[model samples]
Target: MSILNSFLIKTSSVKKICISFFASQFTLLIMMLYTFPIINSQIGTRAFDLQNLGYSLSTANQIVNNLNNQTTELYLFPQLTLLDVFYPFLLALFLSSLLFRLGKLIGKDNKITSLLLYLPLLAMAFDYFENICIILMISKSIEISKSFVLLSSTFTVLKSLLTTFSWIVILIYTIKWVRLKIMKKATKSSLSQS
Candidate 1:
């Protein structure tokens, strides 16, 4: 926890935050515009990771079964190894940095804020675990356990919830920060006029 707090505080600069935000956006654009479409078209449905509401074991089996040679190849290589790997990490960094900065601006940089900053990181970790479960499911040698499927679905649900909650927190802090800046400006203007 101390390590995480130190890392967050160290990386919460405007420059790092902006870079991570744009990089995450660019990666998402690539996934949405290119990778996801191809994979979905090949599989004839949304990928497991995209199933924000989570998937049942039967649905998971169905999706895995639908993976043709090309789709499986794509999913294993670029989808899981490259795009998904980077997207979660970059997004977590951006969100965590932004939240830390916003908390500082609003003068709420305390224990609660520190804990809230963990949301994105937790989401990212869950996403990685979900991907590992997916890889295991995709492998021919490995017997797909009902437990693994359940765990994957659980991780997916958690990732979605944490990510959503983090964004909501960021939005709330952003509104407060904007209001604070405006009030400061208004006070300055009144003093200048007087």
Candidate 2:
């Protein structure tokens, strides 16, 4: 926890946050516009990573079977191992930095805010685990276990939930921060006029 706090503090500069955010966005765009479309076209369906609500074991098997039938695991595996691997880390960094900045702006840079900063990291970890599970399922499609499928689905759902919650928290803090900035400007204007 101390290490996490220290790291967040060290990297929460506005410039780092903006860079991470844009990089994450660029990675996402590449995934959405190129990688995902190619894999989806080959498999004739959306990939497992996109299934935010989670998929059943049977569905997992079906998707894997589709990839097997299409022989497109080559395409999917590289995206998961390369771009998807980097994307979660970038997103986590961006969200954590933004949240840290917002906490400081709203004068709430205490233990709670520090703890809240872990949400993105947790989501990223889940996403990584989900990717690993997916890789395993793809490689072992003929003999994929129900337990592995269940675990992967669980990780997917957790990642989705945590990411959504982190965004909501960011949105709330942004509103408060904007309000504070406006109030400060109004106060300054009134004092200057007087």
lDDT of 1 by residue, 74-130 (tens): 888888899899999999999999998999999997899989988999999999999
The candidate 2 region of ten consecutive residues with least summed lDDT is 68-77
Model 1 segments more than 4 A misplaced: none
What overall lDDT goes with each candidate model? 0.89, 0.86
Query: Whose lDDT is greatest here?
Result: 1
TM-score of 2: 0.91
Give the Å shift of residue 78 in candidate 2: 2.3
Query: Global lDDT for candidate 2?
Result: 0.86
Which lDDT tens digits does candidate 2 get at residues 6-33? 7888888988888999999999998899
